[model samples]
Target: MQDYSEKVQVIHNEKFGRHLVAQLDIEAGDTLVEERPLLVAPHWECGQMKCAKCLQESYVMCRSCKMFPLCMDCQGHDDFECQFFASGGPGGYICKDLLVKNYGVCALMKFLLLLEDPSTRKDCERLLETPINLDDYRDGDGMWQEHEELAVRPLMASGLLMSLTQAQSLTADDLHAYCIRIDSYSFEVTARDGDTLKGVFVCGSLPHHCVPNTVVALDEEFNLKLYAAVDLKSGEVIYNSYTNPLMGTSQRQHQLRLTRRLECSCSRCLDPTECGTNMSSVKCRECPDGYALCELSSGGDWRCSKCSAILPAADVHELLAELGGALVEAKGELQAFESLLAQYKTLLHPNHFLMLDIKQNIASILRATALMNCMDQPSKKLLARRVELCSELLPICRAVVPGISKLYAIALFEYLLSLIELVELQFSEGELNKKEYATHLKTGRLVAKEAMDLLRFEPENSSEGYLVERLAMELERIESDIAKYGR
Candidate 1:
């Protein structure tokens, strides 16, 4: 018998290059791998104070280098100080002038500092050897060149680099290669306390797919956890959706092309109907009952399945663009968005991104009501109606976003919360019998359990990430209610 317990193995091809394939039958929610990051430092965008040791947001600043913060747990540790001083910049006292430039510059500086260690430098050199196509870097995009000069080159020239024998003779070209590697492989790692940092997982081998079968999230320890989102057969290739799975095929392809410099040829990308969900399809102007699907080939026209009438790509583009503008206009306005959802329902498929977008907006509105202090009868009714809308969205979400994605977890959480809210509203109004209340409470518990399981690894900073605590409370409350009812 074949040994399928190896978990995953690396496979290479001319088309997809190096990617991970499952070596065993894996069920959804099963942990595939846990990888410790090679390097972790603050992102250029976040200026928040975090522990230099673990990246936790709650911390005390280092006495010498005021810029570097350390948690109480890491403080007074001789080893930590020795490592910091060896890093060079954390050697002397830091002033405001140096502190202001501590954003992306420090991350790069840390990379240079790590190179001073023989073991870490060897791993970094291995990372630099990873193949990257030059075409991914656009000449028109000055950001890459700017980062290379401001962050990369400066770090290469710093005393930190000169102190390391391995990195001492590093050239600008070598620095440019490191920059590319960082841009390509770095994952945004967020700590349990909401502190965020960017790091590269040198040991991971997962590759991108338009519709991913796996979900990756950071654990409390900042190690990357990979889970099988769907049941994986032995020898199947594992794929991670690099872009948002909620996005339509055209949008996903466009994003991958711009960012990864490659058009996806995944089954979903090749299918115009997007695996029969009709997510990218729109109402055909030529026929009432028929929907138009874009031709699979590029520059191909959208044609109605019923009437055989074709619409040019330009016309379809203009229509979607108009709907996109309307979506933006209705952003925070509930009534306007409700009307837009109805209007788009007539013009697009139920599973279209625009329709889903409005549904999500409505769900957000309902989810927020769970936190409301008071709810009158009318407010409760509105909440109930929106809850129904959220229920309708679940099947589509499950079909496309099968994994433990934020969207899937959020929808499940919102639906469960709405159920709990409705039960409470009814109980307060003397409308729910013990039997009826118990039923809803039981359903809420099950849904909450599933959602919590799905979002177990979600970062604490995300909108729905904090729901785990609330969900736990709701489930506990529901179980008590069920016990009181003798269920």
Candidate 2:
């Protein structure tokens, strides 16, 4: 409903194909762009029983097609799709069982339907196509076999091609190209009910950075809104991170390369200390109290900041691989994570990404235990540990992901919740006077307000958005308690 397109412009260069730049000076939190997705499809991993229309798990099937799943409320919504599925020629009816097993076929069908519209087809043509390497699939390690069986064979057997080709010509190669384009450019959006869906957007395909200057959010209908994460001067390029911000430099680079065919040399990626957070750092074996920082560039050796001891890049990679394997084997077990934390405490930096990951898992476990409403000794200990882990993570989150970040917001929320619980426990145990109780509640109110500001833009149906309402209620309760304490 609001237009911010005039505030930003798309530009092209030899280095980066297409990127957005600020047309005017923009303040932090300013809306820079808004657009709806050109195409939306269920994620490949969607469960078999999810309704084709609402994407909710349902046992009801479309009575007309008797193939596609649909709840009673969603029955009429699939009229056109149902007709096509039912009208396929002899032996052409797409088996409901097969469609359930191969969820990707439904997405391909949606793409083909969109291609039938001239304007939509033109938009799809403008998207960048990812080149397919046949050799990668030759050994059955790639998605080629899966695509052939699930997508190509099913479409060929259906009447979708006949209906779609009536207006314009299409070939098997064209379908393959469309698949690659979708894979390269689509965003994984969480739907209103938490189902994952892939969406391709025109303006959203542009900007790429390791440390993004913009944050993107999607509402219930998958309408995207991009906000400036930091203040930007006129003509400055607007960038968005394509990978997880919490990942180590090497992990982010590898994910970017694999997903987007990008080799990121962004400021964050180039800095060995990663803006002084040292998330990728390890302990220096040669010197006491020294840590080795990653050399992000190829074939560069890590050097100790205090002792100047050298560690080969290859050895660092090998060590990381071994640790990563062990972490996978831990499988979210509390004892396993404790073992990892104790074993790696002497080998890795205190804030190393791997160590942080294990701590996050531990915090999650402790948070769950603390929220169980038990005021026993073990519960209090778990609450204390949760508070401690969140305290350690908050500063690193601030250092690495400075402005309005989801990671920072969630950590802050967890920390504040733990702090509030501890305060209440202390008050109930007579550990604090009435004035102390009111003072702690006042502090919690401020923290809850901060968390509210960070989560303001989350979609109403999302888990984070739900937290906004919870924080508001929390603030009200804190205010009441503070008043009762006469502070």
Candidate 3:
């Protein structure tokens, strides 16, 4: 494995409960480092046998799809439950690699390299065919602890392990000694057998800042690395692009409630400072000669902060038009589309027609980012949320747009993926309902059909559009199976 000087440290701070910091001044386009695999497990019918989530009896489910095993008894326990809301069905892919052999942290770091990205081309073009694990290699729990004494397996097994220096720099300890996050940042690729990696897409690497110092993109080396778009002094916290550190208590609280698991009381979160400008909402059109409009107060009449005059609600329509046009054109603004959303609130209520339009744009960006980032391969909550978002948007899409828009189509397609997850979840929970499973499978097929139609115009819908397009074939296959076997 390539060795470079990387930094890791643990520290304590009030802003972040318990934090970790890593100081590696990655040259302009250098790839961010990878992490040491905490543990390695056997894959398939090798030495060990169990599910990734439930740790129950695991068997090779499918050699082609590479997913979960069908379990009528334990659907709720697996990590990536099928997306269907129904209980049990053979329609979902089963788990084959419980221990993630032949894959490890290298794969994790590689997948995470894509984050907050927009295009699916960047994702699909990459070669990620999995490897087979050697039967002779099997390590028990002590194997993970052996990392301190052994160099990671051949670079060929995975790739360069992430520098441990980075991990130490980014964390701190309390009296209890358990690692609480100084900031939420860490890679999620667990080590599989042969020291291979399973579960790509690193998570928990960024500390929070109001304005991010870095943007998400793949590095020149084809590894996912954090970049410093702007300069920063030592001791300043690093951050990712998509958030408003400055907002009101209620607003920040709500977002945190949904995204992060904490309720924030940070300075920028509660009180408006910086430029004495309102952030929680868009400025109203009361009176600012040159300043843009936004929500002036937490509540009440709308007006501009720069000039204290009142903005009439009627003119908001014009502002909405401007906001929509700018939002559509901002090719490089994936992380800060909120800036685009600000103008619309001046005219419409939180859920007004124009405001909904802005939300649709925001969701579209988020969906694209999620796929390129390989979110489903990692975070459980993110996968579930992605499933939920697609489900929520479907009805709205059918009613609002005549046919599904590109985003809507992608959302629908993603929802079908979600149904598969639902099946996985239900099956793992041991509550698989064949009837419900069939229902969800059917629903997913319908939605997949709609999304395929939309892809004609909006190809940027999801990362797996082509995979979803192939759903029709899978559906026909499933129908034939049902007819032949009488399931």
Candidate 4:
């Protein structure tokens, strides 16, 4: 295996399914993981019909069974007969097409064919030892649609035919064919317990579990980390978290049943309980009664556990979205995504479904800036949307929006200004005592400090680093005045 410690890495472990354990221990605000995508699959092609031979569902047309495609490599496979074409043609597995199309036939198949001949399987095996950026065939677009699967027969026949009264000698075309027919498989290796190095375990190697102890969450490094969500004994199996942490019982149960194929009978799923609902409203004495429990609630939203009263817009969705970005980009698409510029042009429009999505977004961008798209000088509508959304997304907005983006920076400024104004009014109205006024001013100072955090130094003066600094100093001055006059 390739040693990647030079790039990025962290300690991780796996254990047998003897006793169950929690995935990881996390503080209320501690970050558990971070990851970067080695390869990504496009979202649009994931669910599409894929060629069984190659796994490509896009671009390349399968040759023999023209219906299912191998893109280009296997496009030549048609010279020979094969299944997976289409109805009334050849037919095979649909999903494998994308995988086959891009990577070509399995690397192992090619390696074996090379060894069989005086060709080189050693070279192939050497390549296999390292991590290669290969697209997945399981999802349609995961693999590039343009590559052709490799083949092998010709190379083996090459030397034999040359000695005889062969009309033709083995050529590049024949060897290429041999390369495509090779079959390959995938496996993963990790320490069985915290410290023992076991070999690799193949796919579906372990039996399925409803709720296993070892929780698998991807750390920021994009590698899966097995955590002890709860403590475990020496002999235990590690499991991964299957759904969102804050998701309610019914939703969680439904997800497990639908995706993991297990009926979750966990205590939380069985109990008609609501989590975090009444916690918000009960704080302000808004809802005296505790929030109602639901075997199946629509969603937790802002409903507090202490009080069922709806919490005024806290922009929790935005908070979750920002946090979720780390994971979403890490696992990648299982298929790669379309080019960003192309995707925006294709998917986003005023009356399109995404517009509906934009409208339906529970996370108000008005409260926070976008993490990815909020950079650069966007179109009018996008800019307006940022202004509308990040106006409310005070703390997280700067993190999401680009410092150089005019609207995003302006939004931060306005957000800070509004806060400063709100607290300044506290002094004007005498509703706030001297201490209260000072505290409010301090908050304004913090907001200004956040603006500086948003500033980034680029090759040259990237953006408004000093401007934010000036604003922070201004907030400090306001705090000083509040200290003197209010007393």
Candidates in order, TM-scores: namely: 0.85, 0.88, 0.31, 0.31
The digit string of per-residue lDDT tens for model 1 on 216-283 reads: 77655656667787889999988777787778888888887765666788888888888678889988
User: Which ten contiguous residues of candidate 3 have the minimum total lDDT?
Assistant: 174-183
TM-score, candidate 3, is 0.31
lDDT of each: 0.71, 0.75, 0.39, 0.35
Candidate number of the best TM-score: 2
- Model 3 regions more than 4 Å off: 1-10, 14-32, 36-204, 215-224, 241-253, 263-303, 309-487
RMSD of each: 4.3, 3.2, 21.2, 17.1
Q: Which scores greater on lDDT, model 3 or model 4?
A: 3
Tell me how far the alpha carbon of residue 243 in candidate 4 is from the true structure, in angstroms, after superposition: 1.9
Model 4 agreement with the true structure over 1-487: per-residue lDDT tens digits: 1221121222233322222222333222122222221111222212343332333444665544543334454435422223312333212323334333433323322233333333333433432332322322213231223122222232232232232222135454333322221211111222211221111111112223323333333212223323223344333333334444234444466665543345665533444432222111112225543432331345544454554655433343343344345334523331122222133333122222122223324233322333343433332334344344335343232222222222344456665654554455545667677788777666666656655543432111212434655676776787677668547
Question: Using alpha carbons, what is the TM-score of model 4?
Answer: 0.31
Q: Weakest 10 consecutive residues, lDDT, candidate 4? A: 196-205
Q: Whole-model lDDT for model 1 versus the true structure? A: 0.71
Candidate 3 global CA lDDT score = 0.39
Q: Order the numbered candidates by TM-score, best leading.
A: 2, 1, 3, 4
Clash numbers, per candidate: 0, 0, 75, 86
RMSD of 1: 4.3
Name the lDDT of candidate 4.
Answer: 0.35
